[model samples]
Target: MSNNPMNMMFAWMKIASSYNQMMLSSSEVIVRRTMMMASGTMTLPDAMSMMMEKGTIYATATERAAVAMASGADPAKITAAALKPYSTKTQSNVRKLRG
Candidate 1:
């Protein structure tokens, strides 16, 4: 990421947008999964798989953030790194669920 203030601001804006998108996708996933469960299409193992996937995703993001902080990354870079996995996963989930 550029060190320019304007560029940093844009980066933050992008991150914020990504965060909102992730949240929206997450909500959609939850609702869809609930509906699936209600209709007996989603089983306990499927729900457990979703939970495990979430845990893995969170752990990966946390590890990335920790590594970035240990390396003395700038605040914006650290946040961007942390958000990357979440953004990628949620975007993927959105597409998969839509299909």
Candidate 2:
């Protein structure tokens, strides 16, 4: 019962754009990190130790970056408060989908 089909289409387009931005941003971060790890710039043990020591910070930063991308916020500022999370064991509602 909507009067404006064009408006609805535009809204959907905006949502698609937001999702595309989020995917691209997340993929970029993942690919960059993978490249660093694969390039042997850091030893496996060193990387593991660093991740173990800073796992929570890394997770928080990644989540914030994804949210910022989806919301169309400036990527530069996403890490400004990423280390604010106090703990790493926070519960998530995301569930795996089964085909």
Candidate 3:
């Protein structure tokens, strides 16, 4: 076997760093995605308050949000409405992070 010691070390380090970056990026994505999804879901207070205040609306938070989305409205409007209920600043933030 031919030996190229310096090249092998450089190649290995490059690969390792790239792999580490990938892992970090993926974990961040998962956390952020889950959080965004959570926003679309209803919280306990939202559920209880909606139930007590609006008897006609579904008691489940997520189900209510789903119904709103299914009503053939604009997606941006839907996302905008959902963003305020959650801590995320904007829906575009998620897309920026993804890229």
Candidate 4:
């Protein structure tokens, strides 16, 4: 990313937007999963798989953040890098669940 002030500000705005979208999608996933469980549509294996998927996602993000920090990236860049996978996954999940 550009180190120019304006560019950094825009990057931050994008990051903020991504975070907001991720959160909204995450909440929708939670609610949908909960409803499925309540309706007996969600099996134990499915719940386990979801949990594992979330753990893997978190682990990937943490690894990326660690690598970014080790490379001495600026905080904004590091955060953006770390949040990338989460934002991508959540948005994908939202689309898939909706369909």
**lDDT by residue (tens digit), candidate 2, 1-99:** 143677656655655655555555545545555666788565677467546745665777679777866776543334333422422222110111010
Q: What TM-scores do the predictions have?
A: 0.85, 0.37, 0.40, 0.85
Candidate 1 stretches greater than 4 Å from native: 1-3
> Which of the predicted structures, 1 or 3, would earn the higher lDDT when compared with the native?
1
Point out the higher-scoring one by lDDT: 3 or 4.
Answer: 4
Residue 6, candidate 1: Cα error in Å is: 1.4
Task: Give each model's whole-structure lDDT.
Answer: 0.86, 0.49, 0.48, 0.86
Q: Give the C-alpha miss distance for residue 91 in model 3, angstroms.
A: 18
lDDT string for model 4 (1-99, tens) is: 667999889888988998998999999988888888899988788689778888888889999999999999878889988998898888887786677
Highest lDDT against the true fold, candidate: 4
lDDT of 1 by residue, 1-99 (tens): 558999889878988988898899889888888889889898788788888888899899999999999999878878988998988887787787778
Whole-structure CA lDDT of model 2: 0.49
**Which stretch of 10 consecutive residues in model 2 shows the poorest summed lDDT?**
90-99
What TM-score does candidate 2 reach?
0.37
Q: Regarding lDDT, does 2 or 3 come out ahead?
A: 2
Report backbone clashes per prediction. Answer: 0, 0, 0, 0
